[model samples]
Target: MEATIHKFEDVLIEKNEVQKMYVNGEWIPSSSNVTRDILNPANNQAIATVTEGGAEEVDLAVEAAKNAFYKNGWKQTYARTRAEFLLKVADKLEERKEEFAMLETLNNGKIYEDSLVDVEDAINQFQYYAGLATKPHGQTYEVPDEIQAMVVREPIGVAALVAPWNFPLVMATQKMSAALAAGCTVVVKPDKQTPLTLIRLFEIIDEVGFPKGVVNLVLGSGAVVGDALINHESVDKISFTGSTEVGKRVMKSAADSIKKIGLELGGKSPNIVFADADFEAAVDYALLAIFAGAGQICSAGSRLILDRRIYDEFVDELVSRAKEINIGPGWLEETEMGPLISKDHMNNVLDYIRIGKEEGAEVLCGGHQILDGDLKEGNYLEPTIFSNTTPEMRIVQEEIFGPVLVIQVFDTEEEAIDLANGTDFGLAAAVFTNDGAKAQRVIRKLQAGITWINTFHPTFNEAPWSGYKQSGIGGDLGTYGFEEYLYKKQINTALEVKPSGFYKG
Candidate 1:
């Protein structure tokens, strides 16, 4: 399909008003009668309005999903049938690829080509889960005393998924597809800053003939809609993707109801480079790990830990390469990096950069926001690089979800591992080294959930993706992810033979 670039006014579904919430497979206004404008990150213009849902909307969505789980046939449907519907959704997404891609780019301020890849990846996630719907593994066991036993996996009902704004459509699809594939009903509260693409996605879901109440969407701030969803009694599970602080709050809320929770939260991941490693390949991987998606991804390698032997040369090369990164509007074809989600977020990133400088780090390259002639209205920041950073600096400890990289040097592999594990987060880490034994040892010792050897950010649908500590709980994007929304049941039956326990009889 050809790419389509849409203006803010031309392709939006609703203008100057909150697009109605999708409940029970239909679009309707919130019971609260309140709405908020959804702004385009590129120009900070109001592109559309989204429902300002509150506790009341949360109740309605939960009730609808509960009804769908019990009263409706969505869960009871055959696994193959569910797979067929998911496959159909994937097909429809492919059919409307250009539209969804344009909406994602406009809503999230990612480059057009990158947004297209995200749409394609989202579709692939649906397709992958569709294939797995009928393939859940069950175990049959033989009992000792004339009893037969078997274990089956059952869907955990009414999942409440709260997605982050960084990769709106992709993250929503990741949780939604996996839950739906497992025959669970879902109520999603997309991040308010980037709700349009997800709302548009529900439009397609409605058109694809999903049963009423199987999937629903509500929009509002995290404090409003997000909190309500987490605390709802009927919600059986909570899957969230955002910051560690918010993840802790959600975990506490879920604790009240004892609801199952899956969290993919913040990261201060490290990308370690050894002197004997493939220099060109390591540089390329490091660049993509931080610059791609403006470094908003939780798995982004924000810390560059280099062997002290080659620290000076690596910093020079990295800085020189980052200087050439093209920053412009997402819609432009030549743009490599685009604006942050909003001016507020841009300012937050800038504040961190200032903190890095104030804390005694050297600015190796770009540090200021870019407000050039044509790009004045957008929230663009130059690809930033800092050197002479210590593991104790705030920049190395906090998740600066922007295109910023902090460089630090370590003398030995043991010291590098210690430095990498110093942070509270343990989401992802990478080691670039030619020494096979050292790489294996480092991988085993790293506290992160996902580690790369001589590479970075090579995620697959089959691998479990989550974090170890404050980064979050549970896994997403694999068979393990599917199991997160499912519960296990054991069944036992007496055989024809009578037990001889009571031999006196």
Candidate 2:
């Protein structure tokens, strides 16, 4: 069978009663009745309108999730049932994947191919958690005494799931599927800038016969709806993916109630290229690491650590290829890189490019925005590379979430390690080298939770995904991620019950 391509207009959602907040298994409008236009960053045009929700709607969603967890038996729901529901959602999503991909491309401004990958990742999250739902949970322990003891994992009740805009569907599902699979009811909120894909996901959840209040979505700014969701007394756990600044705020808000939190936050990851590495593959992955998604990714390899032996040649080659990256609308089949998430983001990146130059970093290539004929209206910028950067420079230190990369050169392995771990962020790091033992040694020394050897951004669902230092708190994928929505309780039973001698003293 041949692959099918779609026109953005052809796969658009049918306009009905306008997209609304989903709560308690019902499609409803926000009490505020405020609406915002969802824009295509590539063209700066409104793709859809989503109702804005505030604290009032968050309370409602939390109430419904609480009721589902406590009153509707969702807390102790059978794992097999949860697995079945998850499988159903996966099947339904696979059926509508093309439409989902189109909507994602239109809404998120990633290349159409990247959008399809995101949709597939979302589906895989559901399926992975589906099997995990039915798998054995907890562990048995052997005690020195006569009592038999074991730990059982239970649902953590109501979970507040916050997603970012960059990879809308994938991030939302990364939080939602794990919570639902763990038998916890949820209230989901996508970043206000991009909520279309998540709204459609709610529609799918409703169709898959999930129990009322088992899942809900509240759409609004993080300042309003997000604050309410995190600070709500009934919310048991919070799973958030976004910037570190916002993540810090979330940690504080969650502290008000001491809620469990799993944050996949900001990163300025280092991609180190040693001279002995396969030079061509190194360049390939280096481009993929930072340029993919137009550098909106939190874990993008924004810091390129190059060995002095290959520094000049590698920088020249990288700049040449980055200059050729086809930038255009996401819906285009040939666009290698798309526009930033919005105009503000574009300006933000351009400002960083300016900062890099001021900080005495040489602009190897791409130091401005793309304002050419057809691309004038869009939030597009050139893929930028900055060399001759120091560890103390702001451009090397800050998390510029854009196509702006900083290059750092090191002479020895120790210097490379220091340069890689110098920043405050430790979300991810990669080493491209042919030496097997050196790869292992360097990777072990790197201060990052997610690391790659001779690779860039490939991650597996079976392994835990997390960060060290300021990047984030806790994990987001794999068994560790699933357990984030669960509560561990130890059950102890005496083999023979008898009253022990009581001491009055």
Top-TM-score candidate index: 2
* lDDT of candidate 1 over 1-505, digit per residue (tens): 1234444335676575558888887888878788887777778888777768888888888999999999987779888988888898899899878778778888898988888888898999999999999995899996687778999999999999999998899889999999999999999989988888788888788988888899999888899889888888899999999999999899888898799999999999999899999999988888999999898889999999888898777778888899999888777788888889989899999999999999999898899988888678888899999988887899999999999999878998889999999999999999999999989988889999999998888787778889999998997999999999889999988787666576765
| Pairs of residues clashing in candidate 2 | none
lDDT, candidate 2, 197-216, per-residue tens: 88988888988888899999
- Per-model TM-score, in order, reads 0.96, 0.98
Candidate whose lDDT is highest: 2
For candidate 2, the 10 contiguous residues with the lowest summed lDDT are 1-10
Alpha-carbon runs more than 4 Å astray in model 1: 1-10, 14-17, 497-505
lDDT of 1: 0.88
Q: Supply every candidate's count of residue pairs whose N, Cα or C atoms clash at under 3 angstroms.
A: 1, 0
Tell me the spans in candidate 2 whose CA falls farther than 4 Å from its real position.
1-5, 14-17, 502-505
Output the lDDT of residue 317, model 2: 88
